[model samples]
Target: MSDSSTLPPARLRPEAELARDALSAPVLARAARLARWADAGTRVDAGGGLVEEQLPAAAEQLGLSGDDAAAHASEAWRIAVDTGLVEITDEETGTVAAGEDLALLTGGSPQDVLGVWLTALEAVLADASVPDLDDLVDAMAEGGEVDLSSLDWDPEAESDFLDGVLGNLYLLTVGEEGPGEAPVPLPALAASVIVPSDMGEPSNEVLEQVSDAMMRLDDQFRLLEPVGLVEYQPVDEALMADADEEPAAPVDEADVTRYGMVRLTPLGLYGLRARLLDAGFEAPAVGDLSDKGADALLDGTAPFPPAAAHAETELWLAGRSPLDAARELLAAARGTDPGAPLRRLRCQQALSLVGAEAEPALREVLDDAELGGLARVWLTEHGARDVPPPPQEMVFWLTIDTVAAQLAAEGNSEELRALVEGLARQHSGFFDTVWRVEHPATPEVLEAMGRLHPDKKVAKEARKAAFKARSQQGG
Candidate 1:
């Protein structure tokens, strides 16, 4: 994935809810239990791993059973150590004690608990990137020290690959056009990072690579599920064959689960967003602007998806009196900057959520040049009696402002094209009157209409009008 600064915002669950999830995740819960269970009597190896003799006892403590029970206990112990749930009191003596952070699980704020969980997640991610124990043992059997080349695992590359996969998963979960909470097919996800975006058809070699990535991800997600990062359906066991051979093509739709399917849990979204922010990514969440001023709310949510923006604005408005919020929003919306049109658009959307109590604030702005048209429209829509019609200049100015806002927000979208066509068709001479509007975005809006309007002659009229507006502005 590219630098995460460009990633879309993730709508995360509340911190308190996610903190509860972190505490209940199988891996984290076991790790916490083991942390509480450990005492001065507990012993660790030089590496701070639970001593070999204690593995069975630890598994029993976690009530874990099966062939993988001991391995699970060991993984939990490692997490306990890595996240400071258990401290290595004496490295030389391999003595262990409950760590300071162990107290945070019960006493700290939700953010503090989540911070510990993030640390544990990072440790798990590092462990997931490592080659299998069997592979490691085979490599070491030759001379005791493992040969990395023999294992064919580049630690950095493996780590980066997992990060890329997780990043792609994050995108799928949060992108406006993504699958949202629906489980992504494993084959599709593996291909996302393997197949070139510009490539029309994947080569045979590329397909093989994708297949290999799927198997690796199957293992990784299995490990990750215990940590509450993903809800995963593992690749079907029947599908596994010789590692060297490729399976047949065209997996049936019904058999998609045979390859695997995965979705990030809500907790996973919180965890990944935290990681992205730590890496200097500008990852925004819905309520991030709740405590901020109206100007921040309008400017900040300008780039958000409609639903996210509404959710954010709703939260921002929830704290203040509707009248106060309306006044603040109206004051912030009055600007001549390039971004001001979208700010006004956002303000209008936010005002729709305000009750009739904000009528006074709207009435106060009804005569202001920049705000009068929207105020009149809002008052009329709310059934305020005797709301006067906006003057022709105000109507045309608002039209230019609205079109400019749409262009900035949607970028010549299908809806905008339809809008441009409708505007030209509805008015006898739209371009002729629109060019004379005093709005700062008049020329730009006209130019966009010239490009978006499908009628050739109407499009020419819009371009001519835009040129006239530019010349008038220069004069």
Candidate 2:
């Protein structure tokens, strides 16, 4: 039979494509791990079906409880048996019958099982809507058994079959069982774009190739057209794919000597701006004139004239210049007067433009007593939403006051409610203090707090508070 077209498309990298096929590395890794674990001489005599005593031992070996192990093992056996990986003798026997071929064909170590699990994870990552690990765990805890027999698997396929199996498992685990909001799956196509190590200044060609690859993968996956390129360093180096051994020839400055300076394309600038936005950055202000102020600064080398500094600053903040020029302007503005409202604003704008390079300077200013408030606000706005606010006194007060004002000014109560709910869910520990002070204790507020609270006792406390507040208001 012809190769399955349903598998993800082949790699488009002209050079890399020839070096190796798009094998699921995670799957292979997981399977190999599991194989090693099973090889450690752990045997499950399913002749009398899966026994409770056998489960706890296996679970302990796997660093899990007996119930969890039994559940996972039973599910695995059921799936394997249905997929023809194992055989069953008696129809009445609920336990799996390990035929001679079972050990040789399917048996492996704990590491091997992990490899299998990861292989499945890789496949699930390809899809945008699959549930995450926590979701899967909860589903399993609810006694949901995965139906591996129903999945389409062909042993004869040329590509990695185990990878697909692991992918399905990963998907099943991450999927939501009830009609509730689920975790957003990071786009696979977006995930494929690799960032450089330095992240300072990649050659134009490298940037172009990455952008092109992103667009191509986006088309293949049918993902939403990204507003702009979002570049972030992997949290851990281990998360990154190993770089190719054969490196491309370094670009010489002499090669571009005849061309003078490289200018940023509008799209490139847009990508830069988007990247900043993704990092939680805001546009700097170049005075009152907006884009014009930025253009004037880009044209000349001198410090922005005081008369036009505000407009100029705003322009700088708006990210209107070539990347290098933008960087220079930002650095100069920061050096000139670090405390200038316009400077701070410009600094915020510049940090976003500079990407990770600005982290040190931003962090430094973030600790200054006078500058920290503005610096942190700007940083927090531009950085990851999950980043914790600075523990300083003024910053805390400013943030709380700002949030309160925002909640008060919100035009749509429904939207405000949702926003508040999300905030409370994410920072439930602060709910009693923040929510009560800023927002009136409505029935919706009580429900939202209760839903997001991890401890049942805390949720009960919140409900009681809401009830007391409501009763006092005679609602």
Candidate 3:
């Protein structure tokens, strides 16, 4: 994903809760156990990996009994050494000792423990990018060093592809229309990166690539699950028994999940969001604006989806008095910049949540040149009596401003088209009078109305009025 794109905010768990999860992750937990077990007698090769003689003992120490136990122990030891949970005391003697970060796991704050987990996560991710040992062995050159070209593995490309997949998964989880908290099917997730979005039908070659990608991801997710990044249901082993057959497309909901299903755990969400922010993405989370001023709240949430924006605004208003919050929103809402209309729209939405106590604040701004139309609308909506009707000029100005705000907020949407048509039908001479409004966006709004109105005569009138508006503004 481009770093400049703003992602919908992730709803993260508290650091304390996430830290508990990080500590309990199988990989990090085993790494910690192996770290504490290391002492002066623990031998290591020049690369700091535990020597072959030590693997069996290390596996037994962890109460592991399996053909893969030695491999698992070695992996954990690598994590411990990489994350500073174990340190080699002397390269010549091959002696070892518990490292400083081991203490942090038990004695440090929640953030500190999570910091260690992030380091281990990075190590595992790097491991996941390397070709499997069997592949390397089969591709070995005469001198025993692996030939990367023969193996058909591009280290950087593999890493980038995995990163892109995780990024897509993150977007799926946090997106407004996505399957929030539900496990995404494996074939669909694999297709997201491999398949072109606009493609009508996949050829045999593309379908084969997707099948290969699914198999690769099944292995990757299995490796990743121990680090607590995802909760995964592995692709059923029965499907793998016949290598010649293409995996069947899931016909029903019951059959789909057997292919594989995966979702990010809450801890995974926090980890991925941190990585995104580090890479310069504007990844916002709910409550980010709670303590900010009213101006920040309005402008920062200007591009958010409607539901997320409402949730953020409610958080911002939670601590302030209704009158004070309403007054602050009104002050921030007064500007002539291009973004001003949307800010005012957001201000109106915020005021609606402020209720009857903000009546005085709304009444206070009824005489404001920029805010008067908005204040009057708020008062009338809340059932206040004796609210003076807006002057004719004010009504025209408000119409232009409201249309400008909607244009900014929703673009040339069907709803905006309907509103444009409705306004032309309701007013006998709206185009003639609206052209004279002194609002900065008047010409632009009129031009939009000209395009949106379906009636030929009314559309022609809107274009002429737009021309008049531009001439009056001398632009």
Candidate 4:
């Protein structure tokens, strides 16, 4: 045998190395076969036993004794579960049952089984601190074939070998660390790893085709579990004659053959994406509400520029009706000119027609700096009516500001007076700021401010402003 230790380092690309490592291991070869079988929709059934009878036969075929076969099978099963290739369930009787749809062993074609094993093996090898290709090949080739009938059944040895293999596989594929210490799995890894170069977006049609293919593969493999029944026969002829009675009702073949299917989960979606990416399609970025005019349209209080208004209206119509023509018009307007005021006005009018549903999207844009003072004021006036009460942190200031502004804007002098008095009784500083800086300081405004100014300094300032406004107005 060649001295693996003395061999020169093999110069190969990462993909080539992965391909080589995958082909070197029997366990991985078997796994790859299983994956292909699963992809093809093959069904694999396990007989009712910890070690199925057919499993031994398959082991014998692979040149392993019963113990070795059992060991390898157990290891494979454990690895598969750890890698999420198979799901396990607990029976009421405390037995752990493997799902029927798991395409491991059970007469799946060697190629299919090998493909799954390789896929798993490749994943493990990606992170494994393997010494070299020679080391990996040597480790895989260490065990020799055995005959089951000649070997003694040592459950512990089998279990130990399985544990060792799994440990090595884990270390190789992930790292030499416990679960929490390892890096979190990325959802996009599969896309980067498995998909080939030709497949495109995972359209519903493509998914359906893949699902159909898997279903057909399952039917072809016949890897489904079988139901066993006990037959009680009389030992003696006389007893048999005496016990003779109607045969038990015929077993329903359909009931015995039925098995549940495994549907795609989120992880499976990641895996599917990976497979598609491997197969060669670029995943598209899903567009969000911000991408549409919904963000600008939702704030009902804001005075939109004609372009923004048109965009909002188009978005609303898109949500409301089949306004394809209107949408086209909006899109055209946006692309038409840099400073088209009339276009923007037209857009706003269209959005105004859309109404309330646009509120949330509009509110989201209130913090946008680009919208300018006009938009902010429009949003304040139009959006405030529908704006949910300000959150707790802002409530105190918001209420004071709202009340003060309304008092200044109110047409009725008596109501204005009452509002000003209320402000003076409450937060006088806030009232002072509103009266002095925020209001227009007309005689009515000054009188309202004067009534609320509680501090001597604030009261004197209010009085001076009130007198000047009165003198100017000739009141």
Candidate 5:
């Protein structure tokens, strides 16, 4: 459902605090460590599942009972699998191994490790059961809550509502309300998220609905607790029952509002914070004109969105020498990927700022194949006398530039592949001709095209071409 309210402001945090919390949170990282330890000491069963005895170690590691041991191990394994920390090639028979990303995650900076974990969490709703969970959470995020009556309340919608409440639980944890910072009470969360104005006070049906909502809320938290994203306390006795047992007894002992609190762990807070940033929440942009030179400023602003970069560049280019600006710009442009047309255009804008003064630097690179095309274009536009026609290499680079610009602007991957194929078909020696062009990005472009190509055969040829190009550059 759509709503007009804006998302809550994301609190700006220091790099030190983010890294410290991520390192201290320790649950997912602990799970990763255990996965590695298990691979060495414990044997995998024939079915590729961990041996039963290993469950005790995993459970004890986390301070759970033997009854909770196996489930705990299974949940950790699922987390490991989902986050690419563990790879089981064949679920039924193949041996488990630590995944490629495992080392990068474990050994990398805490900031990066938390980022990887959050990325996995972001995709947690990909299962068929909760496909629209992210969308529901997004709706609720507006003003930090949506009206309960406004939502569809059928069986599927009830399920979504449950997930949405759990998402809100994370939001509430990070939000400061009186600063005690414990898990938010279930009823309090419900009251904030759900507005039931139409339902009269204290009807039997209303009470039952509220009771069920609490139970569902508790059950969802229990399920998530094993994944290390939350700490849910005052366990509702109803959830301790086996799946085969009679359905959980309705709330009887105390008020439904009295218990069942959930809160985000430190890592969970950071994860949600990252999501807020991804959803267009602004954070402080540092490394501006104060310390960085034109070269550093150009490099720093190069990767930003066009409008933001343009604004930043306009400020940065002020009070700088035009000739020096041109030199820095051309130097920066030389380092950009051939396949990144947008970067080249930004380079063009920076180049244009230099006017006639940049001609001296442009002359130096005019005969250089990789940079020559840009130089030629810039010089011709400035009314330089009788510049040579762009060579085969420049034409090839420009073609790649055009396709990249189209892809970045329109994002049609299918059309990108088709465009690449058409160019390849037009010249059987396309790869060979481009390989010797001496442009800094020639090899990079060929390799990137290989990855982007839909057809395996073409991709393989593109890769081979890239390898050849690199070797030519080396020779």
Candidate 6:
């Protein structure tokens, strides 16, 4: 219930924990300075996006070249926006200004500052390295998850070309670590070599270009260390004896360069996870469930979106027997929590995926009114012999409950809205009949749709439908 700053150390310290691995002091200092300038009402040049022209002014102020100023502004602006030092209200209209969080950050601890900076690091990478990263991610994902390892090289040895640079260390954190293999060191030169518009194996010249890009990026990465997005060290303490000086490198390329194995740190892994979610990627959080049984899996996913929970359930059930999986799911759904209704809904979905094998276990609950509706739906959908239809009210209520469960999960409201609106249109007197249906969540779902539907008319209609449904129940 508390903010990250107020919470205890053992209770989910994502920012502090992640910042430990990266070099973040410089980034935090720059972000703080940018925030102070914003408090004085500074702008990133109101005319023509400012990097080419106004960067010189900023450079003179910061004692750097125009190009360095541009790079600093590019990174610092993104950090500011992400950490609430700067807020971009409208990208199209170019409306941006300092934010309320700037003052809070000014007084923040080093961990807090680096944590906020880490939060914005993903967006900074997207701006600098992968402009169309969003589209590429959409193309890369399959069955609600992204798997770079699954991709085949196209007659060129360009395996994980995008993944190497843009794929990031997030995958490394969540993915299966190879058995007995060392931390496969990815050097600085190997870090670059992007294809620009194409994906192919690199030539010697391409390696040089990629190496150059990595060198430039290494500068930014050094500033990133305290935030923990990436890690590099001197491999000796005396090398960086002066705390204010930039850390010295190994100075030899054959074994290690100034920047050591510059891969995504564990902290960077989670930072990327958050960033991916913000951009609408269904990044998986399937942590170490490889050894978990059906009971453990169901217990863990009780509150997950049905689609996400179903995917996890199937994975858990893959090595086990379907009937057994169904039994375990049904057992977990029998919890007495106030949230049991939605939990049962997700469990039923997983049971359905187990197919007709789950019917025998489901049928035992058919007479219990609370769970019988779900059982009836499963039996009817699975073509069980001699299964009689439930009352008209039960059918309608169950349909509404299914929609309610999806709404609870916050999955694809656009599709849900379209489906609900279509059903309302198909039945001309939708509200009249639906209001009379006896369902506990009918009013709640309708009210939610009223607020969530994009169209004013549809939203208003949903509100009216909810009022009528409430009145029918005399509420």
Residues 358-439 of candidate 1: C-alpha lDDT, one tens digit per residue: 9999999989999998999899889999898888899899889999999889898999999888888888977888898888
For model 2, residues 1-475, the per-residue Cα lDDT tens digits are 0222111111112222211211122222222223334422333454533345655554444455543566654433333333233344544544333334334333554333332332233233333233234545554523477432333223243123222322322222222231112211222222223444466666667655544433333232221111111112212223224443222222453332221111222222322222333344432222323334433443321233332333444444555434444445434443222123334344444444445444445555555543456556655766634344666355433333333333333323565556545555665464354434322324334555565456687667667756654665567
TM-score of each: 0.95, 0.20, 0.95, 0.20, 0.43, 0.41
RMSD of each: 2.0, 26.9, 1.8, 27.0, 19.7, 20.1
> Candidate 6 — which residues are off by over 4 angstroms?
1-299, 302-311, 318-320, 334-338, 380-383, 436-438, 452-461, 468-475
Cα lDDT tens digits for candidate 5, 1-475: 1233233322334655655554444446555765575564455566455667777777676666757567757556566666777777655554677877678654777667766567456434323233244556755736778544444535467556755674466445533342224767665555444537575555665555565565556656665554445677744565546655322223554554246667776555556555545655432142244255655665555445445455566666665677777777666665445434555666776776667877888877888655688888889989988788887767887766655554554465676778878878888778767766655656766776787777898889889988998888883
Better of 3 and 5 by lDDT: 3
Whole-model lDDT values for every prediction:
0.90, 0.37, 0.92, 0.36, 0.60, 0.57
Q: Could you tell me the lDDT of residue 173 within candidate 6? A: 36
Clashes of 4: 59
Q: Write the per-residue lDDT of candidate 4 for residues 167-285, one digit (tens) a residue.
A: 32222222112231222221111122223348786555544444333332222212110000001111222312534331121135333112112222222222333333444443211
Per-residue C-alpha lDDT of model 3 across residues 430-467, encoded as one tens digit per residue: 98899999999999999999999998889999999999
- Highest lDDT against the true fold, candidate: 3
Error of 1 at 323 (Å): 1.2
The ten-residue window of minimal lDDT in model 4 covers 223-232
The lDDT ranking, best first, is 3, 1, 5, 6, 2, 4
